[model samples]
Target chain A: MREEADVVVIGGGVTGCGIAYNLAKKGLTDVIVLERQVPCVGASGRCGGGIRQQFTTDANITLAMESVRLFEQLSVELDTDIEYEQGGYLIIAYEDEVDQFKRNVRLQNSLGLESRFITPEEAREIVPLLNIDPIAGATFCQTDGHANPFRVVHGYARKAQKMGVEISKFTAVTGIVVEDGQIRAVKTDKGTIKTNTVVNAAGAYSRDIASMVGVSLPNKPYRHEILVTEPVEHVLDPMVISFKTGVYFSQQKHGPIIGGIGDPEEPSSYNISASLRFMKRMARTVVELVPAFGHLNVLRQWAGLYDVTPDAQPVLGWTEGVDQFCQANGYSGHGFMIAPKVTELIAELIVDGKPSMPIDDLNLKRFEGEITGEAYVVG
Target chain B: MTEIVCRCEDITEEDILDAIDQGYTTLEEIKRVLRCGMGPCQGRTCIPLITRIVARKTGKSLAEVSRPTTRPPLQPLPLSVFAGEEE
Candidate 1:
């Protein structure tokens, strides 16, 4: 069926679904979201779902705080069990990063985040099995947590649909129809969708989606792989991050040790095959961080592409020379966490033409010279 | 007399071997042409069994056989699920 809408939201991941839901909730009904393949089939479901407010930049912190607040009330808000736990985020400061961690704690506190410096004894209390040796000081934040990404994304999409927002899954957005320096419509494999407003919320494929409209978004897709062990009895509570090893992990409520380390030199390609290099690095880092995880057998491993922008900051808002177009991509690897807030901001911008929060710092032009540097060195 | 590899689609060892002989190096290529493990459960229910068959037959190491392309819908939920069909 040929279709048209007030806004044509691209990609059915969490970010896209968030925009759709918020828009509909804010009284815009004629919105249709197009998903190439299926909802949460991209980076949303494949991510580690680590939510944190301890960030270095103002924009990142703002988005993360907003997202954490939304997530805290999301179970009742969405009428779906997202399994969000506010069990705090712990970053183990080992070796030389102790100084960096202290600086980060100061900045986070100045920004009114409830993060602090803790002794190794306090760190051991949170995670008993964690090897505290080679540790300087541990940075702790009570607000950071995790949720089920699939459930959250799907829940948002479901709510959007029930509210009269049309979501077409397995429908690929083939191209964008731009004319007179304005977005005319979006073309799909099935048919064409005529709309003035377009949101490029297409996760890892956001770069490709932007290119469809003749915009050069400086985002490259990088492969990041993660593995999970068989569910064990609850052995840990807080999620652990090592500034030294670039590894982050947490044992879920279902009790499978789930996490992945940042591979510094992951190439810009979609090669998601399980690699020996990834496995060895992940295994070594996880084992070193938590010695108790040594005995657990990894049930499976998988990979997904991170929509990495230069400087690892998210590129949000309207594209250059584009009318009625918005971008909520280039989140590096942190898309899953702040997706709700980011998408909500996009929705607000679409409906009210500006949000209550200041999204100016997150503008796409920041990559050129609008330097607002973020601090949270998370993967 | 090789055993069946793709437990989901029931494409056997001999079928995969013949496909390999025809130059299908990637599991995705074999899946596309032979429809081996591209069933309802995706390769989740079939991959381990297929990997054993591939490793034993080709004499490739387990690590080599373990490295298969991981596509989306990692858990094999229906497309209708994403469509919010409520079935």
Candidate 2:
């Protein structure tokens, strides 16, 4: 299936649709998205769906604030119902880390985010059933929220197509054609697509996709597991997080309690099976956090891979000596939430001949161990 | 009754023991030969049952039974829903 297009985007996850949406909206209409399997078969649909602006880095914090604003108005902006609930974010602190929470809240407030340290009593006021004794302090942000991930990708893909972008699902890219140090075309299972400009948004598999062009991406897959409870009434209004335990949960509109925890030994893979240890550990944390969830049965649990870079920040710039090759891959775990601005940045980098933001600091070259500092508050 | 364990693939504890007795060592190999948990719903409903069966049959810990493969449509919808108009 040999074809020609103005741009060929690889990987149909959130970032892929994001880049396509922005490019189509920016007037580069001849775009084709080649997906390996169905869309959202990757990390996009499998994420925690928590959108927050709390970050240790200035760039991520600014991008997240901008992203939260977009998510707040995304339904009207995209002309589709995204079910974006502006529930607040609660980060619980225990042990000696209570001081850390206070310092983070102070820094966050100084950065213009509506975050502050509160007493354990205030924490329980937000979530009545939460265990407040062992908890020393908490950071509350009123702007952070959660959304349905499937709707986000579907929304962008729909809007991208409405703006004239072609997304071909089940199209696995096997090779990238480069000639004279420039990307010429992309070879996929369906056929070869002749295009000078190509964007790599392959999520966890970004390293493999970039390797086809002889570029070694530092991105690697890490397993993140999540679980859901049987439908319960709307009791929890805010998205709760425990910095001590890697647990976060939100009561969805459908009434099911959805959330996940970070695993220390989560190996890299596309594997999505839930583990017994994770269930037991997650159950323990869930019961400790919200005692009311103890009686509710776990309907299902699942796992997905996160594309983790060395610094955990996304690599979002063109490679040296590789012309016409733009990359927006390796968000580590924050890809889904920041995708809108990331896509717009990548599209502007392509069409406007430069990025609308100061994205030069995000190139792959910054992760050579020289820039070790990055955001720490990830759930 | 030992019970019919995996309803999605109609696998039972007796069938699992039979596969292990036939020298099927790994879970993947046993699943390949017996079709233990393969179906439209994938392994969501059948996995815990298979894990329990394998742990009971092999006299191993529950954690040693190994995790099953999870495919896409984490919730399976019709391909048609993804088809038709791009918008």
Candidate 3:
């Protein structure tokens, strides 16, 4: 815990670690990451780990596609096997959504992605046991996949540490010292670190950190629960996502079928408690999709927060009033998948004062008026 | 039969001690290393005992040794709850 640093990042989730790792690797000096809890102990660790580019919104598709490209080489670069499975993402559309699904697939194709629309039977060909009777069609993106959230977080943390970046865990940031409208220091539970730059990569806690500096982020934390079944013989290959049921699942290489469902009734709060409702709904939906997974014993069920914004997109770039305060929050549920690219671009923005990636459309001001194009969120 | 500290994860007192000996002093670290309270029950059954073990081993007061971060669903709920009857 130093008394001063060049930059103080306020979170230990994959976002913070990834930012720290990229900053340090990019030759930034005196960078320190302050984590209130252990690394990967937040939403970054609790997610379904699905990385996909099959999104209705261009912002999400671009971010996710770039993330997938980075993930393809992350294991070797970080020297840690992230257990990345590029098996593909299979999105099953119910009869009612076939038209909209085709439009999304067309958009994805125009964006240079290799994704395509396929018949439900074609989806069955990919997953073998999919219940295609009720599904009208599906979209397959071979580049989309899943990775180990734990390993990715740790890998970034370890690499950041190796690059002389100090990551102080169990140290909570209590306040932000903004003197004359510029970041002066970061006050933490452990100690205060004087710095000019502060990155709020706080995930669900981003709002709290932003409030410390009087910046209002429109992101709220919503609870999302997930469960893992006892490892069975590998049955599913691509991740099976359904828009109708709001459920998505994938069998990991080591065997457990891991997944979750989104509850529209879930309120915005800090609650991470698992709910019986989510488990049952997810189970029933899973069974309804693939009857063979009906009786698979659930090994564990847990909940995590999703930092959702008004348009279900992320709020990136520097704040309006704050000179050196940058935000990388409001990722909704896709933070882990887009972390590598997000953090890389953030580092570029912080270090070079401008990001090469086009992120002006993702600024915090988008929610000030009528937002456009609601992001297509699925299971 | 020997006593069990964490039933859901099948973690015993000895496993906790061995984890501490291996230098995983904190509850979260030990939990990660030994899967002590990371089962379906999510540490409700074993956290107190592990907290005591960690305190005793580290010679710190209960308050001095931090409890593992309590993540949500505080209790495991059935999948049926989220799956409504309309289905």
Model 2: CA > 4 A from native: A375-379, B1-87
Candidate 2 lDDT over A27-114, as tens digits, reads 9989999888666768887787888777767778877888887788778777777778878888887868777777777777787998
* Stronger candidate by DockQ (1 vs 3): 3
Off by over 4 Å in 3: B1-25, B30-87
Per-residue error for B68 in candidate 2, Å, reads 14
Per-residue lDDT of candidate 1, residues A114-192 (tens digit): 8998988899888889888867779888889898886788788878888999888668988888888888988898899
True contacts kept of 1: 0.00
- Interface C-alpha root-mean-square deviation of candidate 1: 16.1
- Please write out the lDDT profile of model 3 over residues A122-224, one tens digit for every residue: 8888988888888888889998999888778878887898888988988998999887899899998898899999999999899999999899998989998
lDDT of each: 0.77, 0.78, 0.85
Best by lDDT: 3
Task: Tell how far residue A253 is off in model 3, in angstroms.
Answer: 2.8
By DockQ, the best candidate is 3
DockQ of each: 0.03, 0.02, 0.25
For residue B45, model 2's alpha carbon misses the true position, in angstroms, by: 12
